[model samples]
Target chain A: MSPAPTRRWWAAALAVTLVGLVAGAGVALSGRALLVVTTTRLPVALAVGGLALGAAVLGVGALRARRAAALAVALAGAEDAGRADERARHRRFLARLDHELKNPVTAIRAAAAGLPPGDDPAAVRAHATLDAQAGRLAHLVADLRKLAELETQPIEQEDVDVAQVVRDAVDDVCAQAAAGGRPAPAVRITLPTVPWPLPHVRGDVDLLYLAVVNLVGNAVKFSPPGTPVEVRGSDEDGAVVVEVADSGPGIPDDEVGVVFDELARGRDARGTPGSGLGLALVRVVAERHGGRATLRSRVGHGTVVRLLLPAGAAR
Target chain B: MRDPAHVLLVDDEQAILDGLAPFLERSGLRVSTAGDGAQALTAHAAQPADILVCDVLMPRLDGRSLVRRLRADGDWTPVVLLTQVGESYERSAALEEGADDYLNKPFDPQELLARVRAVLRRAVPGQPSLAAASTLVSGDLQVDRAARRVLLAGVPVALTPRASLLLDYLMTHPGELLTRERLLSALWGFESMVTTRAVDHRIAEIRRALGDDPAAPRFVETVPHAGYRFCGPVTRGVPTSGPRT
Candidate 1:
């Protein structure tokens, strides 16, 4: 099907033809002996033998070259596909950024246009709206920056107390809820009791704390008010595991895989106040610390997020 | 008539300081303003406010440092922190530095007012009325801290001192996740080398004494990987004569 293989075929045919002609010429030049051989058809037999030998050598070389060329094309195709995939990911990232930015900018613009030149209450209200939208935009940008940092920054490894980290996360979640005017959801923490020792994990404490906070906060955000969010810690298979479980509407099975993707939100979380970077950040932080973040959920039950970090030696 | 509770609002942003001051004043609290933590300290020294509402990030000094400085000087002025949204780490850090409470920025003025009032009530001396109830009653389980007794179905349960203390703490902070470390530090103090396992032993003992099932816990719920929580709705019960703190 390709030109190189076709050219090789043509060259093999030419070699066979040339070899047969030469053998025939040599037999003819031998005069009466050649004429006797030709009469007995022995000269034709030698010509056929020479053509067969020539075709075999050239055909082998052609086949090898054809195989090599096919391999080269396949390799190039794979490289092209990889490049295309990278490009598509970049495009998607930009599109998501644009989509996130557009909302607050549009709101700010609309509010600004509605602003009147007065110290009236309506003017103050508009100013507040503009300020709030600007804050939203700032928060989105900040989350994006933090996510970028998490991806690129080298993590600081130190022995961290898992129980202490969980406490800090719970405290933060409560504070955030109270700030948002929502009654603080009751967060219950269960630590592995004695016989089961509390395991120290090796990671950046601040980053790990942030990841836990994000998990707990997400659980709280998705759940209805008064539903208890539970955080539990244990060591399993040489890894320190912290699980944050929420009695919220669970993520659908089809949407579970992409929950760790940047800007990916569940259908049930449409009106929720989040930048959709929380889970992605958690996954990044866990992975950077030589650990992993995972989620388990059932639609009607609840969602449980597990953050596992490599267990460090007891300090 | 006593003076209205005074609040000192500190933030680097003039717009925020301006935006919040009037709303707080409208909520019936006397408000003072400071541009940053340093100014807040100076203002507090000049005339102490009933409570301090400070931003976490600001010029001259930050909210955490401000609270730390105030606390170091034995100034236990109930302080509330204002932090950026999603900065939960900051909120906890501020709390560790002795801040009474915190609110995330772009907050509803109403929430701020509520926190201000709540913190004032807690910080004010001789305000035992705002303290948690002395006795906790959940269904058949009754924990009376003043009496140092736990009763199930009106029958007294014999509990060791350690078990009694653990139960009292859990009952006092109903619905709160009390971690093993917290329990250890609270019960055994910082010098105790007792591992979290000891806390579990005490909890088990208390659970047994109370006849609480771990699998389907009625009163003490095990929040897997965190700690124990009193899951039942707690109510104030009439105190009986017993040991008093």
Candidate 2:
């Protein structure tokens, strides 16, 4: 059997007390009245019932408030934990960056210091290896640091020329394409011939360029030497729309949305060098500028990436 | 005229400036510095620099504002931004503000130097003239840079912005190895996540577009552990499609 309800138990006990009190008072106030007991019972019964109802209502309201408070506390704790974890991760990443920067300098210094004139071919190869590794580490660290910084700051905003941004991106990747012996993708800038400062955007110029650099760089990396990467931009929906379309293999449908999360990597794709924070960084930067980054792809066809920033906000 | 490019470097970290300036100067460039945006502007006005190398974040007016202010003045000096963060937002902002180039922090001195040289070369007048062999070709395929057109088999193939750039690079240096890092940085405009397999995807797409077999590629050959290479021969004026291996 269920335990007696606390409310009911209390009500019964209080009713007995009230009845006894009223009966006693009636006996004292009225000397020897025959109907006194009956009269006392009625008043006592009403008092007990009203008190029980008021207590129950108050208890329920308090319980609800307590639960809401607990939830708020839990959420605050989670946010704090997230911030701390991010800090620790950032420190490690920066440490890695420092090590990377020092590696190249160490190598060059060591090689220059160690190698006597007329060193053997093997020694030369060793030096070259050190140099190459140093360069690699440097690049990796730089990329990581960039990813981290983009996550943390307010990018400076200004009136920037979108078309120029495209041209600059191509130029930046040219050396890489040449080094790979991959053909540089063809560029066709189709902005209005009459340029008017190309739309002033409010954002961090360096960060924006890097974001575009990453897109163009990725295109060059994945595309075959002779295939093309199409870059197109226009003012759409009151925002500046920049799209980088590549003939390369497209992202899988399921992985598109999550590609922007921190350290997210695609399934079926592996063995490439990166910290997996690139897209996450891109998303952070885009949102900071009051813009957005999106991706679309078909398995056999290719991938197209769109970055949208509010148009007049560029000023 | 200043023979050496005068550069104003803005960074909150004193050590970064201390280490960078000497290294840059050693590369035969004159370097100046600012701790923040306000200082950067004052210094910039005091002595107009040929180029600017500023960090993305700083106190009292960060690097972005510095670039914008300079551009607003119609100075048009080339600027290369530096950053600790790898986000596209910062990169996009820098580009919009008339920045010529950008480099992520913890970069190689050599890579930074190369970029500096590239930017400065473009800024300086008449360097394009020194590029006597500017027209790059591969297997009778040619690109007329001045006209901004690409031709294959005596016909011009309309290419999108990215394709043209890819072709341009391939034609410029026909037989060298290029790594994925280099290509991604140049094309995508930002260094992407390290785990991305996008490079392979892009290569496949390019091969398909070029009608080349991955098994036996002709114009573009994959150099495992290295990068991609263009393997065709060409004459400047002739327009011929690259051979399928």
Candidate 3:
């Protein structure tokens, strides 16, 4: 890797060539030179002795280098295998947890859906609570499973139109918000036109879909009903940048740094219904696609979450 | 005047069976339950159910294999697989294996019931399931989806690639009201930022190629303030004889 080692190799090659020439000349000059003079001039015994010593030293050096190289490869392989095993164990755990939870959730949901609307107010409230909580619990399990799968799965790459992804995310957020018994946020999608269109980002469309949905969903969830959730898209320095801006209570300065962390929740997000893993998913998706997700928020003002990704050409 | 539709509900969990069986019965369906895929197969052998609702991850013979086995034996029963995993590959793989449709688990019973009803409505006796059918015929219009070719009145109709894709999606969905957002996502993945006009542009292209009238349309119909739907009845696979020009 270094020039010094290359230079050393060249020098060693020259030394070997010179030694070969000198040995050949000695054999040719044997009949011409006097035997006593030739003996006085560096004896054949000393030359053979030096050559044997050099060969032994070089052999030991080569053997040590080979052993070190093998050891490094083995350590790297073990580390990778250990990581893969850990991922598999995690997947199995999630699968078991999902199965164990899914059956009961389905049962509870069915029971609630089947419950006839009675005149009793308390029973109706209890039914509503049970149904809502069951749905939330199911959502939590799904989120956990997706996060685990994302860690182990290889991401797909295709030319993804950012405009389409943005629209899909907004629609998903609105539908989810409506399902949660809240007014759907009015989303204003802003993208370039006429001069330059939004660039396509080559990545897993589904993963990008997931990432954007989480971003806009989180923004809509934290914001009050009827407030605006604005999405902006543009091409900057050969990368596509999408920003979700929401008029909501912003995170505290101390909590801002950790918003993208796994299972991290800010003080402003305490009462919100979420899995607290959306931002982490966003960050991971962006990083995997050779991009990044960043946030800029002001207390009591608003928050802006930006997902930047390298632009990809036609697939 | 008609008999209640029969549904074969299969799951490994007993509690799931207890919870869903009665609910389905209450929904006016003649629900027969199976403990696992093997049991479902045996039950079907005894008396074939109108439709099968199977859980994908049963211990003895998984849903995919069950569907595969049934399909290999030349059975054309409509099967709807219920999967727990969220992988698109698994769902598509099941579809490719000749399953009619698949719904993710943890879904509402009402949703499952709706999907079952829809699949039943599409099911035709002695006909190949929708998944196995590559050609669709409706009167003079016949499209071979695998060949990506459209023929009207026994004559080839040239269509843009986008129009062809839109037609394929519409033909497959048939009566389903496909919104512009869904169409955009399906066709262009342009779900946001761009207006719904992009879908209209492609729909116009399709209508032009098919010689369909927006008013009293024979093939594609526009639903006011909603979406578009394929109006005519679609028979799965190619007709035995060519359509008369």
> Which candidate tops lDDT?
3
CAPRI-style quality class for the chain A–B interface of candidate 1: incorrect
lDDT by residue (B107-220, candidate 3, tens digit) is: 667767877887788878756665566687888888775565688887888775557667866776688777785576445432232346557866887888888999879999
Off by over 4 Å in 1: A1-117, A120-122, A178-181, A313-315, B1-245
lDDT of 3 by residue, A1-315 (tens): 224554677689899999999987987778665344344446777888899999989976985696677778888899999977975786698779877887788777767776665779998898789888877775566566566666656565566888998887787777766867877688899989858889888877656877888888777877777889899998889989999999999988999998987678887687775677789888878877888999999999889999999899322
Worst 10 residues of 2 chain B by lDDT: B125-134
TM-scores for every candidate against the unseen true structure = 0.40, 0.41, 0.66
Candidate 1 per-residue lDDT, tens place, A1-315, comes to: 256766867798899999999998888887846333345477888898899999988978978888788889988998999977874675467547744453344334333433443688887887777767665664455455456545644455566788888887788778867878989788999998788667888766656776888898888888888888899999888989999999999999999999998788889898886778788878878878878899999998899999988888321
Cα deviation at A79, candidate 3, in Å, is 11
Candidate 3: residue pairs that collide: A164-B190, A164-B191, A167-B191, A167-B192
Instruction: After the best TM-score superposition of candidate 1, give how far the Cα of residue B58 lies from its true spot, in angstroms.
Output: 28
Q: Arrange candidates by lDDT, highest first: which order?
A: 3, 1, 2
lDDT for A94 in candidate 2 is: 73
- A best-first ranking of the candidates according to their DockQ comes to 3, 2, 1
Identify the runs in model 2 with alpha carbons over 4 angstroms from their true place. A1-113, A117-119, A170-199, A225-228, A234-238, A253-281, B1-245
- Using lDDT as the yardstick, the better of models 2 and 3 is 3
Q: Which 10 residues in a row give candidate 3 chain B its minimum summed lDDT?
A: B186-195
Q: Compared with the real two-chain complex, what DockQ does model 3 have?
A: 0.27
